[model samples]
Target chain A: MQSDLKRIVSKLHSGMRIAVPVDYAGVSMALTRPMIEAGLRDLDLVCVPTGGLQVDMLVGAGCVRSVETSAVSLGEAGGAPRFNAAVKEGSIKVIDATCPAVHAGLIAAQKGSPFLPLRGLIGTDVLANRPDWKVIDNPLSDQKDPVVLIPAIHPDVAIFHAPMADRHGNVWIGRRRELAPMAYAARETYVTVDRIVEGNLLADEMTGAGVLPALYVSAVAEAPKGAWPYGLWGEYPADVDELKRYAAAARTQEGFDAYMSETAQQGEPA
Target chain B: MSNVLPREILITTIARLLEGVRHVAVGASSPMPAAGAMLRRALDENERTVRLSILGSVEHNFFTNGSCELFDSAGQGRIDAFFLGGGQIDGQANVNLVGVGDYPQVKVRWPGSFGSAYLYFVVPKVILFREEHTPRVMVEKVDFVSAPGVSDPEVYRPGGPVALLTGKGLFSFDKTRPGFTLESTHEGESLASIREATGFAFEHADSVPETPAPDAATLELLRTRVLDELEETYPAFAADWRRDLAALSVPA
Candidate 1:
């Protein structure tokens, strides 16, 4: 079903497990800002924390109660002040995970498996914090070698902004194939796109292989300049100036609130 | 000119260490190592000889399957070298990327472990790079081990730490001995400072040499090509470091 920004925000409630694509995937912060501004609280957020803009925005708005991800930061921009502050204040539970573990958990859910066995976490503290994870001797190995297995992660909703989605809801994800597995692992997938193309994205030879079929997409919304501040790979580049401004403005709670208010006002439809 | 920036020194040392490697992958937030890897790629006359997959750079990265692809490639032995750092690193090279004080109730919280636990085992030449060499960072034992430096003899491991380069000095990780041994100190750094700053005990040679600064040719290439390429992924770091170099070059 085609939905508006307000309707999408209305669909989210307190304590829902939501997953977004990693920073490099070109996720638009626009899709998430409304939900946070609407006072969605106590969220179980999942994603490889890209640090500055996306995760920091949600955490700064106090929308997140817990975060399960690898790391969160602004990358070249600087530290994620709000997210770091929230963690230090003990207001949020940070599930310190590795990138592979996040992917493995999603893979398990995608495959309908109870858990997925992974390599390299055998002797690390990542396993220590996670009682849900278990290290057992690899039964498939000829010799004795223990491996860490992570439980499946099926999010309540998977949301992201993409380059384009055709009217038929075929998302042209291109090389960002993580969306496929993420959508498969979640109960439903919602998307915001920069534009809606006229024809089916799957019908075009160049974009056919990159299409995330309508089968997995529950809702599609058109939000131009959707991945602002963050770049939509191939379509545009990250707005470095805005990201720098965000890092500076978000260092304090009052400043963060003001910044959010300003953006929310500017982002509204006249 | 004798006057050289510390980052230049580090980039030079890292480039030398990366010699002969076919492929080197640098993680996000590692501008110095990323620059060093690009420098190595530039020095090679043979085109496409040294492949660098720098995370977050469009031109550098070639992965189609997103972040998970990095781990998959490392497991298949495609990556030759990688860089890792820690909130706490012990004598045995065990890195703690989780947090300090205790688990769940941490006194200090760092951004969670991205891939150190996994990459440390699979990537053959994992270089532990840390700019801060204080006791707080170089600890006796990390409260939590994010990735153990040395694995059991029977473990099927192809990758481990080769060397660790800090701001003050360089230390070699001997596989046979499986502990850090002081190799050399930076130009102005003394053995006393290195010892006092370090929390963990490490073996050192009777006579340690000074880490060589980047030669004039290397500096030129770094200033132009490496810095230019680094701007794409790490614009802030590249710009800031460039400004620092400019300030250092000014006559008093």
Candidate 2:
């Protein structure tokens, strides 16, 4: 399991576009830590719709060159300090997007389509800023009706944490179906799971519905509490106090470095 | 009645606005709106229950397909109402969730636009809720239009801003006029005071009435049931609200 993680982490190179799941759907700190430890640089992060602590930490650590996301916030804890600061400092390129646009782009990639047409974004600065996105009249409508066409987003790797995986490498994502699209659109998908089950997940009718086949999964590693601080659905609740502490500490570069060093020394459990 | 907290008033006001909506969706970090939606559900006297989908809540949210399901549902006109708050909201109702100053090179950065860019165009009732009512937040024109309030006649937009609710007052948006009309001032606010604080010009009657306070029954429901439901998603907000209620009830 450790070897698999090391192999997957070794494959990650600088200037790669990596797709990651949103905060609540299991953000893999296990996978993220290794990438940071490897000192990977100039990575383009695609936050599948939105981001939170994971995106913030990567930006603060200087691992990310650009971020294509709908929003990056700490939710109840407050604004993402590092992401906000980086944006203000112009340290990272922000490919600002709406939630649907991000999803639509990924869907286009999954279907091998060039682009997908989406409603709204007309006459807004979001549309005005993106030269990549084009406005075209609806072919079906007789009258003038316009829609925004979002280009396909293909990522080099898609990574996330999940509750469990079968021995065959099939991941059970349950209702967090967004991970499927991420895996489908990316060239490779790596997962860190809490537990590895003995049975074939796809064979069981109940679990089969939620399973992502091994075909999309390149490798799987057993990393308990991989989403520490951020909670996995039904596994545990988010450690709000710890998140708040991080939020306060990451407000400044010095404080962020201190927090990182302290956590590194502690060697947070997988 | 005098012991009512500011947030309670806002929640009640939101509940009133949410009336008749079959399904309402509340986004992340919006405790007041989430509480308001819950209140609307609790206040439902009809046989049909109001379906509330508060994003980020494990209990309330029904979407099995993840965040994209929300946009998909809204696109199909399944979501009746949604809440959108911005860093800067202009008189024209253009919301800037992006940032202040300039595009890409903004002076003050804000969380990027979430679903507002699309949801505002699809959801029939897009309530503009900003807790602070000041010139900095309520501007003449937003630095960036994360989502537009009104679109061109040729635009296939079935939804837009219906009302603007702030700490000071409640204003209704008229798509035809593409402007705001001050509806009612909250407890301590008057038309003159609202005008002084607001950055842009808005249409208001000579004598605008004060917004009605929640009755005893509504207050009881909010303090107990609404707060109870809110605790699941917003624990801190719920705790703080309870603390505020406790302090307010003490003899002066």
Candidate 3:
């Protein structure tokens, strides 16, 4: 149960998928690569392409089965969102990122509550349907409406990389963020941080910056350059050479094993 | 340097740009124009119809009523003017967001355009604004053309840039001029200053003119509408307004 990243991930069987709603650049490389090295290379990653970082990494990891976008980027490819050339997989399903949030909001809308704030789907657009986008309510009533039904997101898990955390699992982002709802919605959540700060050091202003209560996070690894080898705020971009290196080795089981073998030979934990 | 009153100079410049307009659009974190427009409204810029559609409305007044949670700023483009930035602007007027380096990645990676991804195509009068105008910021060929001026008229349709606003000057690109054609510079800046700031050397008109300082009416209106009425009303924005001043990271 208390295995390092390698043992826990390499042990996973197939028919599994994971979601990474990360900012762009190759920042989440280190946090994400371990999953592949640990043996979960067939993951269907939900990406944020211009999201300012990591399009190449997800493609390189061979993890992104489908791209999720409402509109295309205005880039060289005419902002047409798609997977890298090498990732020519056709079986993967593409879904909206906001579908999960809309579903949760729909549940809230139906209950006549302020914010349902559920642990169901909050990212991925399984619930974003119709003109309402996610929340479906009676347009019939002006004063009184009955209910709205929002579809729930069914992603198996969510991974969050934060700046700091408390042992109790109170996560803090150090600034305002947009992904908290989705992270809270995942059936399970994993958090990787540069460091776990103590309760006292965190100013009142910095408290409640992250989303967990300790109980929600299934795994919390101290991955210093985890967002690396993508960009972490105060740090440099991920080591591209290292990432390209990973991409070359993680395409197939043999490649992954050979990569593992090489790293192990260098005295890394096997 | 708190969100001091918008200088009379900047206020007039924007007012003139907004003149003869019936409809206008302003995005999040841009209160100065919204405020000026409010003044313009009082001054009867549109006489009867409400002209400006302030979308991506971060100001609290609009958001609180609807539980006001809308995703992304691109959708609210019902107005006239939309603003954008460029990480790498090439000679072809293409903006880059692809990898930073030659084949793969670049040294400087930007947080890709959040909604510029779509706004560049949809919004009609897209105005490009940037605080920094250095070579890396204004280049010859962006590593990746995140969005280019709509040229492939048959298949693709980008809204096409109307004007570029920078700290040094104003530029309106020609259909043929790589990135943009230099139109004019601010009072203090010179052609050399603009060229030095640009990464890919650009072309300029023979006679560039100085931008006129904002008129008094524009100044008074900007003060009352933007600094006075708007900031006071939206307390949630009070902090950001102050932050923009302290950091000078963005236009206040």
Candidate 4:
């Protein structure tokens, strides 16, 4: 169904594992707001560490029960207030991992494999903390060195914003290859695009190679500036001022509520 | 009389350390290292083949495959040098990029490990850069080993800690001895102060030399071309550094 933000988020239920692309990768921050505004709780949100305003917004709205990602930080913008606060208070479960682990897990699911073998994480704390990840000796090699294997992470829903999508629903991901793996791994894929193009993206020589086939996409919503406060690659730069303000205002619960209410009134995407 | 900033000293020293590297990749939130890499790229006209892949830069980075591309390249021995930092860096060069206190839950929390664990093993010349030179930061043992500085003899590790550059001094890692040896101290920083601040034990010469200052030509390039290019990815940091350089040369 090609639905709006509210309707798309309304479909989310508590305790669902939702995967979004990393901050640098296209993230639909606008669609996530309605889920927060709806007060949906106990979500298992997954993304890379550099999630900046996107993860902080959800954590600030108290929609996340656990975060299964490599890291969560604001990067150059400074500290991630809500995420830091939640971790400090022991209110959230952090499945701390390395970047490759998260990527391997998703890729494993995409390939329909039980697990994916990774090179590192042998003597590190990442291996110690994650019991699900195991080390096995490389059977094929003459020298038996241990290799860590991570279980497949098949998220319930994969949601993100993209620069463009054609009428056929083929989303153009450009260089963001992680989105391809994410959509393949998830049970359902939902996307919000800056604009829906006329010609089929797969047919165009320039954009064809970058298209994520419509067969993987379940829903497509049109939301301009959807990855706001976070840049959408070649489109526009991040709203740094808004990000800094968010970092400050999200330090406290009351302040977060005030910030969200004010933003909600700003008439974000329908 | 000329003036110098501690941070400027760091950049110059890092550039010197990065000499002869074909490709250096600077991760996000690392302006100083990125600046050092850029400076190296600018000064040495002979090494025009040097390639810098700054994570968030539009112009500097040539990678089309996004985040995982760096890791894949590093694994194949393409990226010669990379930078890593931690909340705590231990005696053996093991780093803790995760948190401070205990596992699962800690007293102090920093960002989680994204690629440090994997890249530390693949990249040949992984420089450990930590500006803070306190016992709290340079510890006896890291609380959590995000990526070990030294691995087991059996482990198939190509990349490990080469050197550590801090605000106080620079230490070269001895792979055979499996320890850090105090190389030299930054100008105006005393050996006594470094000894007092360092939590881990390291061998030092009777007389440690002062780190060489950046020549006039290099400094000029840093203030101009380096600063201009850096502003694209690190606007606030570049602006602040430019402002600081201006303030330093001002009449008292």
Maximum-DockQ candidate: 2
**Model 2: per-residue lDDT, tens digit, B81-163?**
99999899999999999899877978888889998899999999999999899999999999999999898999989899999
Off by over 4 Å in 4: A1-3
lDDT measured at residue A89 in model 3 versus the true structure, 0 to 100: 36
List lDDT for all candidates, in order. Answer: 0.85, 0.91, 0.49, 0.85
Off by over 4 Å in 3: A1-270, B1-12, B19-77, B97-99, B156-158, B176-179, B201-203, B229-252
TM-score: model 1, chain A? 0.95
Compose the digit string of candidate 3's lDDT tens values, residues B160-211: 5777777677777665443577877876789988888887656677878876
Candidate 1 off by > 4 Å = A1-3, A49-52, A268-270, B1-3, B215-220, B235-252
For residues A108-199, write the lDDT of model 4, one tens digit per residue.
99999999988877888888889999999888889878888899998999999999998889999987776888899999898998998898
lDDT of 2 at A194: 88
Docking class of 3: incorrect
Q: Arrange candidates, best lDDT first.
A: 2, 1, 4, 3
Best TM-score among the predictions, by candidate number:
2
Superposition TM-score, candidate 3 onto the true structure: 0.48
Taking the tens digit of each residue's C-alpha lDDT, what string does model 4 give over B110-170? 8788788888888899999999999999999999889988878777788889999999999
Q: Please give, for residues B57-134, the per-residue lDDT of candidate 1 as tens digits.
A: 778888988788888899899999999998899998999876788676577777667888789999999999999999
Point out the higher-scoring one by DockQ: 3 or 4. Answer: 4
